[model samples]
Target: MSSRQDEVPTLTQPSEATRRPVIYDVTRIVTRALNAAPNGIDRVDFALARHFLARDNSARGALICTAIGPRLADPDLALETIEGVETLWREDGDAEADDVYRRVVEALGSKGFSGASPTRARKTPNLLYLERNWRAMRRWAPHLGRPLRQAPADAIYFNVTQFLVDRSWYMRWLATRPDVKPVFFVHDLLPIEAPEFFRAREALLHPRRVSNICRYGAGAVVGSQALARRLRQYATEKGRPELPICVARLPVSPSFLSPAEPPEAFGGVNYFVVCGTIEPRKNHLTLLNAWRALARDPAPPKLVIVGKRGWLNDAVVEMLERSVVLRPHVIEAGGLSTPGLRRLLAGARALLMPSFAEGFGLPVAEALAAGTPVVASDIEAFREVGGDAIDYIDPLDGLGWLQAVRDYATPNSPRRRAALERNTGTVAGAEEFFAKIDEFIVRL
Candidate 1:
């Protein structure tokens, strides 16, 4: 048992002097994303919090946005807290978490089922939902504000992504607290990668946040080495000393790896799967084209796209609505249950993810664990996770993706078998990563 624990990679547990650490999760981004529905980042944040809570009884306190109306619901409030440490819901803060959620829901809901089958309810307009829910949220927001004042003194705040976008005077003040050590999770520099999608006013705010992260943060946590390198470069450009950064790969719950019997009905059709929000950086348009090209061949496998629609791409959404070829071959099942996702991964011939940017391709790891082969873009993050296991393709090459998709469909190759074997047990357990976190907290 002792030897097995050592085999897992985690930081040393803190000494007797250190008790359980209180951590604040500052997540304006998560709140906004959740408002958008099919909230992937929010889901990740929830999973991370769940893991931390389950692993250590001593770990306490969490601060999050409550999307409830300015007045509060007891169930939502109670659901957000830790046993000993404080948990704060700051929906009343500048960003107005619930306000955004309502807006996003309405926006998607308003689109009404465009070209969707009567039996298939997939996507909707979310922005309009917010407008309808706004007045109620205004009432709810005030109740959420009162809790932040009472958070535990020894808490170490964990900020996910850039909350600095909201320009909350309160958040900046909270950052300088003497007892709390602020830790920020750097997911990706998407604004840097694809600036056109973001509003100019918003895009300019990150450099200042990066500077603050370097100057004041106890440490910055990145999901991959690729992001760490990008952060270091950002540090160098700003002339700030590079601070300590840790790479914690994305984690899926143990349930995802559980045994599952294949479905009784796959209907004799092979399919490729792509999961993630349908956004510009995800390069879904290129994927659609590749799938279209593949459809020209006889007996082409279906393309299963699982995700909610995301910003600044009306054309792709329209294509999804109008494309004749996409209808029979495309399976658009937006956001699935974890078990459903696991089953899909287990049965899939390959996970086709041509994402141009990622901090750590979590799905790629999940696919490998499910014994599914992957054909991913030859980007740094994928390389970090997939190593030589993935059939790498350039995002620019449609022919390459089509060929790779074909190659992946006809499996039984030695390379595919070896990749799945190599990926097993390669990722560190959640406990180990959290222990490293505990050690980091003690030193601070």
Candidate 2:
């Protein structure tokens, strides 16, 4: 099955029927593509780009915020930038064709999947790409995109990615052009609410981002109901009144949603997976401690941590780098493609996520959507997104997590069977999510 999450272009000849024109912003995706892989927020940005820019939808355009200010990108330039991101993420590639991804899949039902480094280092999409892209953009500036003066009346300036939230100059034009309604997607209030989890600069930057949303935004979008409620409360505390919000639960890609053969049926040692950044907030220490203890078993279930190493986790890095006890049972699979991740999750006994906090637990949802069981932290956001289906436990209760892991790792475990029987997780379709977004725009 293919994933809608990877598609970029989605506009229908730019509607000319006096309907509100949407100026979809792809600035963040364009810039972020030069460095890293797409995260959850990046995926949402791509979805919105597809939704607003559909060839049959409306007469819309794209926006890119430069060092000086926000400027619209012409037709050719916009398409070029989007395609570059699509290609860089391997959105259209054959996952098994790559040896690294093949090993990621192979490790699934084995005693444990040992992660592999690529034989040849992947090419970097660096500054040179950006330099070339900007040059091409300049040449196409006079094409389909027009200046602010020529923009359609009451056009909606929609930016799903919080690309230039800190800078007021990029959005200052909204003050001058009241006809353009500025709508934004607020991914999380994490940096503000959980300041300890992030850097000090981020804590300071988050307030300004939320304040900007309150000061200028006509409407907002959030991934979970818990997050939506929190955003509303935060905005109200900041003196914002009755902000219109659209609560759209993020969708799982088709790769994860498709049915897969369970690990129990694969006739191999059962393994479990933990997905997310290796940071303090993710509570990797607890999992590491638990895995270290599990390693004493004759054949402990393998623990595959699927995500790139993130910031501010010296202890996590230390343990990963130098724990002789952990070497046999743990695999740091940080760079598997989307399909590879889906396969890994599908064959796992359970998706173990003991995060300290989250705006939305996408991996938990992905696991359940794939018909894989989940052992998650007992948090409000997880409760809302995963409901009764999750095997919820306190993030700090070492004994509880240890016992749950032991049970899930066992073959033909009754607890796992019961949980899967009662699981109610369903992946939302691409059109279903976009339909809600469309309705939100109409109401706005």
Number of the top TM-score candidate? 2
The residue-level lDDT of candidate 2 at 113 comes to: 29
Per-residue alpha-carbon lDDT of model 2 for 1-444, expressed as tens digits?
112211223344323322668888867765654544567887788767876766433567777766446776653456666676665566556555434455544454445323342111122344654566555545444444445666667777888877778777777888888978888998888899889999888889888888998888888878887877788788788787567777777888777766655434346766788888777799989988998888877778877787777879999888877777776577667555566677677778899999989998888878888888899999998998888899899999988888898998887999899889878766677766776666666555
Q: What TM-score does candidate 2 get on C-alpha atoms?
A: 0.87
All candidates: TM-score:
0.75, 0.87
Misplaced by over 4 Å in model 2 are 1-18, 56-58, 105-146, 262-267
Give the Cα lDDT of each candidate: 0.58, 0.73
* Candidate 2 local Cα displacement, residue 212, angstroms: 0.3
**Could you give candidate 1's per-residue lDDT for residues 1-444 as a string of tens digits?**
122211224345545213645554533322332242334455455555554434343555555455531111232332333210111222112211333222222222332222443112243434544443443344435545435545556666666655552444535556546666777777777676666755575467765577677766766777776787788777667665446666666665564566654443564357778888777767888878877787677776666676767677687787777786665566665534455566666667778889888767787777776767788898888998878678788988888887777766664746556556666535545666565555555555
